[model samples]
Target: MDTNQIVRAVKTPVTLVLLAVLVYFAANWGLDAVRKPIPPRPPEPCVVQQIGPELTPDHVYVRVYNGSKTNGLAKRLGSVLSADGFKVVKRVNADRDDYPRSLVVGHSEDSPEVALVRKALTNVDFMADGRIDRTVDVIIGSEQPGAAEQPDLKVPLPDGTACLPKIQTVEVNE
Candidate 1:
């Protein structure tokens, strides 16, 4: 064969092989781009809810009456009881006739949890004239000292006075 014919034949085969390789790669890239991705499955729902015992052993309910004007003092007492591992509950700032100012401490009816509540008197600084006449169910009523003032147990009470021991104050913020 002549030189020009030989060169033309070799060039035709090389161009055809290169075209085939390009077509294969183009098809592969096109298929990958067209394919869709699988979506993720959702999480399973919970079936049961469990009931547990009280977290704290002690529960306290404090009632500071309107006439008492000692909300800060009652809050301080609540913080103290809570610090002592007690679950403190507040029921205060209510009408004088409906809720008397007295501390009501008792055990939970459902569980063996002890509770203490302090209710301030209408005109007195102490609770219920400092006389807790209840059956002493978890130290029913106790006179709470002034939140800012220290208690003097030996201080003589005025005539017809009620007295309760001072509970240790807890510095909640500190």
Candidate 2:
């Protein structure tokens, strides 16, 4: 009926609507601030590594022996092996010349240097001795002529048997 009354009536409804909208947004923002943030994702799993045995040829002392009756064989082999980075400690005649093929005698079969030396040489047999010294005995035979070669400095890799670690199995019930 009156202009002031009409203005006041419209203003009350508009103010209530505006206040309701502001309160709705403020309540939502307050709830978001109180809520916990998402945690960072866990790092990816890593592979487990197993330590393996290693042997160095440069550190291994070698003794060349002439299993063949051919003269100057041991000295020649010693010279060649020395040039190839092998530490030739001595060059001498073997106790006997009965060996038909060359031989690589190592103190232990599990050693890394033994595998490396055995792999490099041709037509050679391996022998394990009880001697505590880490010396490798190379007996040259008459059959393997021109067998002296450059030594490979890299250590030989272990076999699959050496790599397989013991694993336990678990049983789960549903």
Candidate 3:
């Protein structure tokens, strides 16, 4: 073949190869652009239910009344208490009467669970007054009328550990 024809033949093949590469990359990019991404699912609701209030001397039924307006702290407290082997008998939204965010230990009498409740309360900074008094049954403070205006139990916690308050019985005014 002549020099010009030979050069033209080589150029034609090179051009075809370049065109094929360009088409392959363009198709790949276009397919990727058109592909749809999957969306994420919503989170599950928190498991906060009344487990019941009946206790033995060794196993006292502890109920944490999370009457705070915000649920973040209450949820955290519930999870922490449950992890510590305390069975949360009930999880209720605070009514007006449930104010002062009380922690009830025994249904009729004081029990060892009262101490555990007290310890847990101290860790929570928003508890109105951490009381472990008898005659009150198990009543935590809520934001309600006639609720005792006591300061929150702010016990100092060690590093990487939560401080739970000590439970003590209060005198009832008859």
Candidate 4:
């Protein structure tokens, strides 16, 4: 208590107005605890299943979308349907873009993930839209559904179980 009486009791004026009201209530409670806002977790349930006998493209699960006007056409076709191993999970923007071709909505356009994403498009078209999980929605239009061939890499599954999707591994930094 002797650094000149603690700098004369912190330069008094009621201790400098209690240190400016404790630094303005700790800078508004530390900016309301750093501008509060964190609620966002609840999206893990992208279907699931796969007993397999054959159905490659990592058991298909796409979602692409980008109905034309091509601006990052559904994230470049969801990275070319995730490098053709499918399981994209979701890319978006399709409520109408004057789509002149591509499409693949599923649930049964000869399900096998909509004929393996309409055989990786080139002028695709197909739509059943029953949607019972077994995801598959391609969409991208105005012509640009190129890359994704596989000409039959595997598609047996006559019911060895296959309601895929649940492989969520996204990390696209670019």
TM-score each candidate. 0.26, 0.53, 0.32, 0.37
Q: Pick the candidate with the highest TM-score.
A: 2
Q: What is the C-alpha lDDT of each candidate?
A: 0.36, 0.68, 0.43, 0.76
Cα RMSD to native, each candidate?
A: 21.7, 23.5, 17.7, 12.3
Question: How displaced is residue 124 in candidate 2, in Å?
Answer: 0.5
| Model 4: residue 58 alpha-carbon error in angstroms | 12
Better of 2 and 3 by lDDT: 2
For candidate 1, the per-residue lDDT at 174 reads 50
lDDT of 2 by residue, 43-150 (tens): 232222343444445545578899887888889878876766667878999999877988888756776556656755677888897444455789988775344365
Ranking by lDDT: 4, 2, 3, 1
RMSD of 1: 21.7
What tens-digit string does per-residue lDDT give for candidate 3 at 2-78? 99998988998999999999999999999988895766653232222232333222233445555656554445555
Q: For candidate 4, which ten residues in a row score worst on lDDT?
A: 42-51
lDDT at 62, model 3: 45
Q: Given candidate 4, what's the lDDT at residue 9? A: 70
At residue 14, candidate 3 shows an lDDT of: 94
What tens digits encode model 1's per-residue C-alpha lDDT throughout 1-174? 999999998998999999999999999998987895766643232122222322222322233332244455545555654554444444334343333334333222221221122222112222232222221121112333322233221212234232222333588885
Query: Clashing residue pairs in candidate 4, if any?
Result: none
Q: Which stretches of candidate 1 lie over 4 Å from their true place?
A: 1-67, 97-101, 105-111, 115-174
